[model samples]
Target chain A: MQDPQSQIVVIIIAITIVLLFIGILFLVMIWSYNNKKLQMAREKQQIQDAFEKQLLQSRLEIQEATLNAVSQEIHDNVGQLLSYAKVQLNIMEQQATWGQEELHAIKDTIGTAFTALRNIARSLNILKHAAATRVQIDMLYLPEQLQINIHDNGKGFNVATALTNKEGLGLQNILNRARLMGGAATIISQPEEGTSIKINVPYA
Target chain B: MHIHLYQYTQFLSLLVAILCYEGLCKYKLSAFLPMLVIVNLIEVTGANYRALGYIPWLSNHAIYNLNLLLETPFRLYLMGQMLRMRSNERLTFRGIAFLCMLVILLNYLFLQGPFVFNTFSLILIQILTIVLSCFILLRLALREDIRPNLWQDPYFWVNAGLLLFALITLVILGLQQYMQDHKVMLGGKSLYKAIMPLPNFILYLGYSYAFILCRIPKARSLLSS
Candidate 1:
């Protein structure tokens, strides 16, 4: 049989312990719930990123294949046709009974047409090669700059080694193109971490 | 006449409720405004009953006991609204609330009588509120569509406040009962008087924050537009 004061003390201690337990339990519940929500959001973002990457890869493949075919057709058929036409014009110039100035003008016009045809074929080939190397490309239009971000989930190479090696012509070409367009390109990659390339160019 | 610090907190919460009336209406929580007004009025009148020379029959204990009757259903209804309880769940809770009220009325009329403090009903209300608040919090935590920023949620704050107040008050009130039954005194003051204000202060602070939180989403939307 405890005294009244001692009994009161015991009751107070018991109540304090119970309140403390409840408070801790409440806090733990809220913390775990918020943590679960954060984890779910992260997983959702990852899935969305994977989907976008897959879609981009498929689109790039199709575009590269189509452009390759077009470049082949232009080189095999159009170039041959232009060359044949130029040869025929040369022959006609050599045997022409018309005014010399008129024949020279016809020959010059054919030469210009052949040069334009070759330029178009070369540009298409460049595009096909670029599409083959890239895994994903995102373009963002800003007030004064156009930003392009390219990401690849590939076995990444050492960026410094690639930039210096003769075999890294594709990497060098990207840098040179960006410099020529008054822009800058940044390449980030690690051995197993995948690659990211960002290009920022002034929009004029 | 004297006003305690806890009563000031309740008044502050009422001010916030009034200021956030439009935002509360937007969130279908305008009922809290009138509820808070009633709560503050009760606190003020109860605290100054002696100075105000009220009728002898209208004791402070009776006023508070009556307040318990009004507060239980009002709080349960607000929590149900926050939970978005389905029709069947709402019906079940309403039934439970009715039973508790019936029990409280019976205890007040037959067991404790009106003049004496109704500790039984107070304990009953505290337990019921604590259980309901815990259930609301658990549902909020486990629901599939739980808000990402739950800390900013108005209902979360409200339930947290309710749970803290109920848990603390339940223990304190029980201790008060023990002291009374055992003829014990704690430094010449009732344990209830010494400790009651702390939970009240915390509860009203939480209410003020919740009222402020009710306006935050509307402000955010307006800013975005």
Candidate 2:
């Protein structure tokens, strides 16, 4: 027969083993539970990202269509009206004798106005091209951060000069909007070069 | 030298910790390196004190009792740091550790003395450790941010191992006197001698795995919160 001390030690060990097994069981249950939660969270995030991407695509399509409509209006309606006025002014100058200087000045003013309207129509067309050309939007998900990149193969302007001058208001608006959303935007462009805009935001 | 299985496991854990020192340092867990070294030294010396012809006064029981006085509080502090406990929680843990240390000193000086195994203090420390480990595990399980990479977390493994070790030791030591009085036996040998080392082995193995996990590049980011 073993001594009482040894017997006690033996019992302690036996009971300990049982308890350890129980402890292990608890750990395994926690692990399994947490893993399920993590998987569910990942799936939810994926769904949200897909939804956001779709929403963005729809918004872009609507914006493109609106720009196209405006471009067409300026080129077909307003542009033709300006040209007709210029032609009328020219005919009036050819027929009138009195107030000839005034008529010439009027004709020159109309000619300048026609040229300005045409320039405006051409600028709208360029904007339409930018909206319709090869444009790519990529959404990159990082830990706690979301990055978006928009690229367009359209005639690009000097980013530095545009940002410093009145022409940069559109770019400034983009930057300001991103900042309002707790994000930042970066635009990369050069004359005749493609444009790429990157925005980074933090999300839970 | 005839190294015990438990000792071998300890060495293996130490080796893994050393191998992952760079990664551990990056995460500010370099303390584990010295802690493991100290634990191995204690284990080796305690096991081979007589053969090495150490002073008669420095018995294994006395060494272990001293270790208990020091190790328990240190471990609590480390756990608190790993869990990123708030200031209030940290204060509470520090208070508990201080109280435990005080109790251990009183028990050593007046109650059990130094010659005998400080079973009372051991049980108290083990119970406290079990509670702390449970709290940590619960916190980890409930945290959504860490849930995605829970398995890769070194603290999860460390806490799990600690919980298991504390639970087993608490049960075994708590019932030691009762079993001894009853002459309990298993396979004609004292069950304590046969199985006591198992928990240590399992714990060290878990630690080794945790150190390996610390080497993962993403571990730092996962633990940043």
Candidate 3:
């Protein structure tokens, strides 16, 4: 007769082995799944960046066209009028009907007005997608967190409006980029003060 | 004649494995290396006792009890570290003392009958190890952060080796159970009674794989970061 005892022991051990195999297979599946998700997120970000570049080019083209139109109006219309006014003042200065001091003061005021117009015309370079408008983006690597700040010396806005509500295209685009990076943007600025946007993204 | 040669030659191989492990302790793989090699030694001792039980001239002898002398605490510590370690290189000698207490308790409870101690101890070791190993694998599976299985990493050879051992154990036990039900051993030749050591042989293969796997660098990397 066979020993019924050892057989019982054999059965118990066999069951344990099968359970172990199942456990190991389950662990491998979860690890592979997480890796797949990380790779997909990286690829999606690349596509978004390419689309943003194309859209930025189109917007800049339209903006330069508007600036160019304004520049032409100031030069062709107001510029000729100012030259005629300057000649009339020269005659006024020679006749001594108005003091030389008064004539020079009016000329100085007109000169300041022309300088303001020229400043607006200079910005057309950026609007026309000139090489000078290229923005330098730097990403700082830190433990567990990523900080990206875009630096540009231009007119800024109230922090409350940018954070609470989407207003201008510039602020809206900054917010969009922050969201893409899995973070929030902090805009620190005043009316005359320049703009600085800070974004922090966490490692996945 | 072939059987005699196999028995004698196998004994030499087992002895060499044990001595080589002792000599190479500087390699530090010996942290749990002795436990594996000693299991075969225990089997040899137990087989001798079982033979004595069948032959009235010999009785429970002193020489074989030497296996028990160093075996209980050594095997327990060896196995305890296998499941419980943070790393292969980090073994606490202090934990070994505690494991001996648990093993002694198991022996006191389980060693009641006339059945061979080796047979029961072998089965017991396999059951406990399988449970502990499965639990470790379960933790690895449930975690979201561990690296994917490094199949190419040599260090993971321990993992792959453990699975291989479990598989072989599964097959051997399943066959033994089948053979028991069929009463295949009833009329077997006395000399050939249980000479087949396929199950234990595979168990030894598993240990050898584990020992050699500790030498693999990639296995450590997979678990570390």
Q: What TM-score fits each model?
A: 0.70, 0.72, 0.40
Stretches of candidate 3 exceeding 4 Å from the true structure: A1-204, B1-30, B34-115, B150-225
iRMS per model in Å = 2.5, 3.0, 6.6
lDDT of each: 0.76, 0.76, 0.51
Per-candidate Cα RMSD to the true structure, in Å, reads 12.4, 8.2, 12.2
- Whose DockQ is higher: candidate 1's or candidate 2's? 2
Sort the predicted structures by DockQ, highest score first.
Answer: 2, 1, 3
Task: Summarize candidate 1's per-residue lDDT along B62-165 as a digit string, tens digits.
Answer: 87777776676677677777777899988998898789889988887899887777888888888887888778777777777535466666777887888888
Candidate 1 TM-score versus the reference: 0.70
DockQ, each predicted model = 0.22, 0.43, 0.06
Highest-TM-score candidate? 2
Candidate 3 or 1, higher TM-score: 1
Query: At residue A131, what lDDT does model 3 achieve?
Result: 28
lDDT of 2: 0.76
Model 3 lDDT on a 0 to 1 scale: 0.51
Among all windows of 10 consecutive residues in model 3 chain A, the one with the lowest summed lDDT is A125-134
lDDT tens string, model 3, B1-225?
Answer: 123332343454444446556432433435444544564455555456665455532333232233444554664454444444565423553454455445544554465222223334434444544554554444444444545343432223333344445544544443443444454442353211342444334344444544443444545645553
Assess the local accuracy of residue B155 in candidate 2 as a C-alpha lDDT between 0 and 100: 82
